[model samples]
Target: MMENHKIAEEVIDAVGGRENIQSVAHCATRLRIMVNDKEKINQEHVEQINKVKGAFFNSGQYQIIFGTGTVNRIYEEIANLGLATMTASDQKKEAVKSGSKIQRAVRTFGDVFVPIIPVLVATGLFMGLRGLVMQDQVLALFGMKTDDVSKNFILFTQVLTDTAFIFLPALVAWSTFRVFGGTPIIGLILGLMLVSPSLPNVWSVAGGDVKPLHFFGFIPVVGYQASVLPAFIAGIIGAKLERAIRKRIPESLDLILTPFLTLLSMIILSLLVIGPAFHTVEKGILTAATTVLSLPFGIAGIILGGLNQVIVVTGVHHIFNMLEIQLLAQYHSNPYNAIVTCAGAAQGGATLAVALKTKSKKLKALSFPSALSAFLGITEPALFGVNLRYGKPFIMALIGGACGGFVASLLKLKATGMALTVIPGTLLYLNGQVLLYILVNLIAIAVAFVLTWMFGYSDKIKEEVEK
Candidate 1:
């Protein structure tokens, strides 16, 4: 571990050191770095390192992809060096004064959410699997349902999955605080205020004619529970407040009083301004989505289906998960969920196709189980080992997914509940057009199989078999 840390430091220096970085962030398995000057960075040297899996440049960011479990530690090391700080010029990266509205919006969204992908995917999978087990009687029978097995098994799983989202503000607060070189505990306090039961409800606080109750007739914040932007704003405020308090208070009582006053002031401010502002933003986003869906479903299906794989590759697909869950909370069912179900099935079909088409005994053996796993919505093996290796499988999966998504949208199929296991969860989206979605997926796999057999097979197998 120590040696790895040293190597990470060296790699950072080789890439151009902390001073060269304008901003930095990490996703599931990649570090996204924006530099003051791209010409100064040595891309080839970074890619040649044994620890680095791949490197690419896209959208003006240099992305360094690492193998599983490696990028996180390197990210931490980079954070420790205070590399995330952006100057006035760096902030211009998303300037409304310069870029078009669409460009600015895209850059802003990517900057805010890309770093949070790993946590989202890990927790999403946990929640999805937990839902599947609890909802399925057969699976629950395998000691998962017994109270005697673990007194709080259900609660444990619920908290594990739900807490990250329920307390998302706090997570963001802590992450952003650390990025700014402030005490993380300050952010935690701000996060707690958002989700606290004691806080006034959104309707009561915002609607009532009361002058918006205050702590000291000064701090103008409201609540924080389950809030996102509020916590982020609070963290920023807390960092500055902490610095001020640290200077004023005596060195002896500094530790105790600084935190107390910082927490109190920041919490109040967050409730007053940040919480309400972001709440409005959230409402506006939902409203916009509803209006968009009211348009022709065929157009919506094509756009969503085509971009689905692209989103997944960039690790922003969790944004869709957030959208789905928020909609489910509001309306109890969402058509977008059906889109994901079909996408998973498409991946499974492609894997099956590759398995059937491959002539190499090793490749065939690898694909067989991977295809089965993909059917269950576990696509990592299929994606990393088969689809990505051969390339054709991924395209086939996308084509099939678009077909299934188009049919699903046309039929108005919606998921009744969420499930991680694709095959078992297909029932959630079942309707009059179930057969069409299935047929489309199978057709996609068949097409992929024929393509792979014709193009990907080795001459050695053909020659020997012919003889």
Candidate 2:
């Protein structure tokens, strides 16, 4: 482990040190980095690192793909170096200053969350599958569900998926702390505080009315259960505090004292500042969503449908997940989530259209499964393989998705329960009018088909026009 840590440090230095990084996030096997300047990033040098599998860029981020088990350690080393700064280049700086309030909020969310998509998808899939298995009686009898499945399937997958959310903070804290260069142990403590059952609710007040909570009579912040932003902000602050304390503490006691001070300061700040601030931000997101969905159905559908593709491209789709799940838990049906489902259905149809129209055997073969997988709510395969490659299919999908989204919103289509997959998941919204949902899905697919057929698949266009 020590030797690996040394190599990780060297890799950071070779990639122009921490100063070059604006933000860092990882996917299934790739470290997605947004740098201060793309020119400053030495891609060749990054690829040369011993454990690095490869490096590439897409959607405005530089990605370093790593073999299994290597990225976590390297990410830790990068964070330890204190290079993750939020500052942007002159162009981005001006955009930040000049952009409208909504634009700024969207950009901020993107900056913080885009890099962490792989983790979200993996864990979501895990959770979804676990729900599927546990809900099945056959699997329930086994350890997979109840540790007694008569079937011979192994139950380990059940344990891993079912318990992911319970320990999710530890995962987020570890990742956020690695991004900020803090001790994982300290992050674990802060994460524990957010999820700890012993913590008192802020809503309780002396006169039987709700009131805000305070931390040690100093900072005022709210509880953070199943939250993302607060813990991240706290982790960064904690890392910085640890570094400052480390510089002043005596060498013999530095190890113990540094963490002690850092943890206390971070907890105070989190409760008082970070947590409440993010709560406000969360409210803002909710307000915006409510306002938009209140508009006429057609306009709402068009905007959401059109933007759904853009949202996924930028990797901010998970923000919708928080709203969908949380609001559904509260309200039993969410208009926003229903629109998102419509958008997914649109993508599925567009991809399927491209698959059918393409003349190239290779393209057709690849797109078919991609479309099917996307219909099942796994989009990356289709997004990267078919729609993106062909370009026009994606454009068609966006337009159709927006149209579908608007219609769904207009109709006030709401999901009664969460879905495990986007397509089959749309069934969650079915309320006796299963035919209406099916019709809506079919309409989106038909629009996508017409658009793709008119535009022509990339491969077919090249072949016919060139001929």
Q: Which structure among the candidates has the greatest TM-score?
A: 2
RMSD to native for every prediction?
9.8, 10.8
The Cα RMSD in angstroms, rounded to one decimal, for candidate 1 relative to the true structure is 9.8
- Spell out the clash pairs found in candidate 1: 194-224, 194-225, 195-224, 195-225, 220-272, 221-271, 221-272, 222-271, 222-272
> How many steric overlaps are in each model, in order?
9, 17
Off by over 4 Å in 1: 1-185, 195-199, 203-226, 236-251, 316-325, 328-334, 378-380, 411-421, 424-467
lDDT of candidate 2 over 388-432, digit per residue (tens)? 655777888887777777677667766544443466764453343
Deviation in Å, model 2, residue 97 alpha carbon: 23
Local distance difference test, each candidate: 0.61, 0.62
**Cα miss at 32, model 2 (Å)?**
11
lDDT, residue 222, candidate 2: 44
